[model samples]
Target: MSTAAQDHPAAPSPGPRAALAVMAVLAELSFVGASMLAWAPLILLQAIFLGPTVAAVVGVAFVLGTWWVVQPPAPPAPVLLRREQAPALFAALDALRERLDAPPLHGVALVDELNAAARLSGGFLSLVGGRRTLLLGVPLLRLLGPQEALAVIAHELGHFSRHHGRLGHWIYIVRAKWDVYLDSDPAHDSGIDRLRRWIASAFLPRFIRLSMQRSRACEFEADALAARACDATSLVQSLARLELADALMRDGLRTRLHELQAASIRPPAAFWDLVADSLRDEPAARQAATLEAGSRRPARRNDSHPPLADRAGALGEPVAPPSWTDAPCAGESLLGPLWRGTFDGANARWAEQIAPAWRLRHLHLAALRAGPDPADTAIDPLQHTLQRLQADDEIAASEQSLAALRQHAQSQPDDAPAQYALGLALLARERPEGIEQVRVAIRLDRRFAVAGYGAILSQLELHGSEGELSEFTRRRALAAEKLESLDTGLWQHLLKEELAAPPPWARALLLEAIAEDRALDACWVLRTERSNDAGQRFTLNIFVARVCHDLMAADEVDEDLLAARYGSYLRTLFPHNELARVMLRFDTEVFHPPLLERFARLPGCEIRRPTRPINVDVVRIDSL
Candidate 1:
């Protein structure tokens, strides 16, 4: 699947350039508005007498506005690889650059996603000759074979060769500057500040809509470049394979997470590495079929790129079919033995980044395993009732299931499973007695994970009912301490020299309790880590990103970098999610408009947002 093209293709039409120029004008106007707001008050007061109180307020406002305008927002840091780190990969990129007549790349970075992009860094100088960084997703690299990889690289590089990267850089800077201007503090109710808000609200959305339209057009042009530079078939195959691989990777991770939780095994540090390996053995045909079935749905209106099928169809016939056996897998060929080492390093970093959440999930699972065993139920009708409670709507159909469980529990007063079922039914009904019933089950049998989970949920409910943040904080700490004490007690019991070996379930329970305690402690620590310093107020973004990393580790793919462009996207769509709510609360109470605007441009990491309002009725009792 080699191509003979040795020079860059003719540049696409200048429509996108014109669109960018308009965006630049809007950005400039925004900057002017911010400057006016920042200095206008101070300048006006200098010419007229004012009270000390009035002067002090205006001075504070001006200083805050100026600071907001001057602070530059940094992009999210990806895992960067210098040329020296992966010589072979850099060599391949250098060769591709030579063929496409593209300028040298500044660096290569890896993101945890299933896509690749080329971005220019710096300001106006960058538009002319900025440092180009290629963000490659390891999963994407692994999915494509050698020829397909080349096609994908060529496509990304095509943007630079055709000057799309340069134009995009200009647009990106202007948009950022506009955000900074629009988001400036509006504490002072001056005319200039009002004008700034008006312009931002009235004009910024239009500019964004136009910019998105141009970006979609640019994507197609880039695809055409790839077709010309590499064999068309390879590009087509790569696109199709990417769609399938992404699906398989997410599904595999989710399935494995369930298994790990069920078995009470702590997720190893190299979890992502394990995920990549699992995908290697999946049947290729099955992935293709999944893609084909999904292709039936229409692409969303706001989709940044054309559908994969459309892109493939646009490429036309290939000069020749890709010879699968002629080359090694793209990742293997490019990085050789270093591929494993690189990904292993990435996995290690990701694992450390998400350690807090990982520990929490482990502990939660342990607490669950230590609770009552539903499988111990000998009454067939009781088991059937439990199944119905799991599958049916809690508010609508749970009454009947609750009645049956209550009857069964009354009959088998000593049965832990029946009692556990009754507790769950009561919790589903939002009754206060649920917590008492769950505790009763734990008294009957301390190894009931479900009962333990129900009790924890009850605590969470009570914590949420607290009227003040200080009260909530105190309760959270106490809860965490209680969990830790349980874990400590278990370890002490196991340390006894004359003690017999614990049963497998008992061993699992101890491990889970430890994990649960660690996770709870981490969550509380993170929730309270928000800073109060004016310069450090934006620290929430970093915290949110860490949470996103953990969610990614948990195999959530819905709000990944590729899916949601930035935090604002997730904030808008999933306001009900706990993470989203956290972000929204911070945005409302702490983040100045400028800081919030900066957040809108950063790469988005999303956790699974709940589809329904987070009420007791919708809470999945079984999944807890």
Candidate 2:
């Protein structure tokens, strides 16, 4: 345990806490009462108007739907740990449970996140003696000391205190789930659905506001109980150090992962080890000072946790320093002798899952170095940093890269990719000339227009003149408005226009693109409204077709595969800098045969037929 344990400090229970707690329980009860009998009145009306049979079917459907929606999500199967496996950990939990006068835990689980939570085991039934499953995050164990881990559990278990009762706990559980779960959609506009929408949009928001107030109050109570169960000092330290650990994971891990892609390497994911070691051994003075994670910021709208600074202040002067000892981490001590075996096994599987995405990035990096190709046209040069510039590793690499981009743009004055890439590079270096390049990029390629406008807004937000942000924000808003209108116009004409033949050049390109596919169907192209300001841009919605009589043979053409291949062929048919930005729409007809049957009727759409039919001599390969 910690070197010392102070007597329970004053836990703030502002008078609003009790009132709001009562409000949340009442809100939940009100909704539950309305929900249970919600369908009865509608069914009664249907029975009076139609008949018993029709009403019976509708009532049954309603009941089944309710059952489906209310069924609690199943716990993650992979990372579940039993008491048999982690006896010491379970023993510690048992002691904490008795100390706090809480119900026995239903289960223990682990997840990939850098946080911990306690969820009710059964959906609504948890209100009546159904225990909670305490979910421990892997990072919590790997990063914290033993006493700190105990403090984490103590706080989570404090929520299950006997006085808290099943009713309040269950209400909290359902309210949390209902935040995202609503049963209303355009397809189902029945009376019950209208009521569901009302609950979601109106009653739910008010209820959330009330429950959130209660939840914040409960946090104070939980913290007090945790301080009592596992020393106050340990609790304070965990709060501070956990925040620092979170900052490290969020800021550093993504960039580190991206860097590994250069070598196509798959190292064992010892991510928690790196964080733990950093904390245990002082790495940087800057990081040591960053103990608070938005601690001064107020609680967010939906989050139950108050700001860390506020939470620490409420508990009295903090005790934890943003540092760790050379002692074994909480995972080693808490899980007893079985810790490494379990952790290493799980870590290996995580590494395996990381392989595909890691290698994909490697391939992407290689392609960038090799230069852009026909099939790689969709690969925006602006998305990637200058790989060649970084390779030189010279003091003047940034300037050299900018100079190279300038020369390329000068040589190909009309090219969009060169302009866009130059714009992106300049913006990275905080140059004003970037804006001009982006504007020219938008002119040459309408595809980059909205995104270019967004980039301009971002730069302005960072370093604009006093009134420039407001002016440019308005400009962005108008650009977004125009984009929406343009998209609407494109779709409207696409659906209603009569079938027409495509340009000769487009037909030949389509034929060349899909020559290998034996799906033996038809390809059609329809030219639509809205090109670049220079009138050089053309966005064609290409429709590829294959008619099938039986839905059972749906695997004849995989919709996903068709979308990926056909979409690529059309999108990157030519280099982005060479010609117009061509955005193609692949057919959902690959899956929806109904849409395929009616596909030909679209205005200005026509199938590309080969010009020459030659005599063919066929021979059976088996005979040879």
Candidate 3:
């Protein structure tokens, strides 16, 4: 939340226009405050008058407010590059920080992605002088020169410039907080919960759009700082390359990367070179690409980023990325040996995690490509698509798709994807029967409900059937509430407030189930119930602790296997079939694992705790 005014010395005070911007932000925050006011008093009053249970909810909410509870964020496939580890890289970074007069970095971590970002760690505490970390992507470093990289770094640092008003700072802070707040448990059925959610859903998204509209100058300010710190040429070139590489990665590299893994095919040793080849469009094409780079779209979502075209124009020219880079990149010059270590280790770790998905794809691909049987009704839609894609046969692909979906729907009417796809296929052919299948899909699974309902609603809207659409839209909104439950403060409050104990039948059922699995340590049952426009929502998050020597190295239990072993029986135990969900998850890393830890600390949260041969030095129940 550090602003330009705080970070930049000798910065001018806000003019009338800037004051109006600050007032606008203050107004947005007031709306949030009003929403909070609706429930916060109730929460406090309940804690004081109701019982200790409500107090627990209040404590969790307060902790969430400070945003300091989720400790030690788990960076995926992280290779922590300390100053000691990469002195040269750190020195360069330090020099850049000094030149920008930015705050001292707490650390730098390298990850395998296509971007670099300046991230404030320790959440809200970071707002009041917390640690800041810079994440450098290997692909980003691999593509740019050191000077260019610094320009990128300077631009990121510019986001923290203190020249802006305090309310402008909240545009970043509260917006990030709002994203997590959105993950609140949808199952919280209280009137207060419903009202709070109504305000958030109806208002916050639009408020975010308005806030972003007001704060675009911050992005321009960041760009200006970058141009001043480095030559405009370096800044411009870096921007162009970053945008191009990102576009290429999103357009095709992701699918290719997955396909290569599935086929056990090693990508080119010079992977960035392969990326560069796809970017080698003619000058005319490049100019067209410039206009379309994350182009100015409607501020419909919470995104605050200005379009690349706008940013480039603000920097005094349009961005035209080069076709090739022959020079030694930032990775070669700045980090040297540090870059070499990441490729084999980081990617290997990533591949290991996704091995199960890869194996499934490999099986399907190998079977179909090696002369698929004519009666192979079990053939995956993706496998068929991949095979036909080679021939560039759109007609064959569409025919195969509809056929595959029809077969799947007939074979397994309960399957959500089959039902959903079949509905889509029918709708594409202008059949009204499609909506029925979509409705069935929505009923079969909440996962399909949101999109399925959307498909139906779109058709209803096109037909000008507002009467039917209104009722259907309500159902879709309810499904949306169910879909979004994790990473929410309200959800955490629900875990503390409502889900203190499992029913006797559920407890006994869970006990009998986990008794047979030797690897299962204990299971924590957290359920949340909410009532709103969605009617009633119920969510069961079962965090299973495994008895193991090394937590990371422990074999992952197949969720379907565990569910098959226990799910049907558990379903039978449910008191009612009111949009209830049971999510069987391992106590793995997540956005707010501390919320789970809070659940564990709750009295009677564990369904059954038994003696396990756990290495005391390693896995701890408290860690959950």
> RMSD to native for every prediction?
17.0, 10.5, 12.0
State model 3's lDDT.
0.57
TM-score of 2: 0.60
Q: After superposition, how far is residue 27 of candidate 3 from its true place, in Å?
A: 8.3
Q: Show pairs that collide, candidate 2.
A: 295-309, 497-603, 498-603, 498-604, 499-603, 499-604, 499-605, 500-604, 500-605
Model 1 is weakest, by summed lDDT over 10 consecutive residues, at: 519-528
Cα lDDT listed for each candidate: 0.53, 0.59, 0.57
Which lDDT tens digits does candidate 1 get at residues 262-312? 454445666654655655555666665666655553443234577666666
Candidate 2: regions farther than 4 A off: 1-42, 46-80, 123-125, 162-169, 173-206, 278-284, 319-321, 370-624
TM-score of each: 0.54, 0.60, 0.58
lDDT of 1 at 366: 42
- Measured by TM-score, the strongest candidate is 2
Q: Give the TM-score of candidate 3.
A: 0.58
Rate residue 110 of model 3 by lDDT: 80
For 1-624, candidate 3 gives per-residue lDDT tens digits of 113212333343357446545544554454455445545666778778988797777856864563333223434434466677777887877776677777766778887777887665443424354456778887777778878888887887765544342345545555564443343555654664565566666656665666666567666777777676665667767877776676556434554554564456333355654565555542547545543634633333444567776776766655665535567778877777766776555556555444434443344344445554555443455534434332221123356656766776788777665566678666654467889988787677665676677788766643425356556777777767754544244544643566645554345445554544554555566555554444445454444443332332455545564444344434333322223344443433222356555756776557656354333333223322
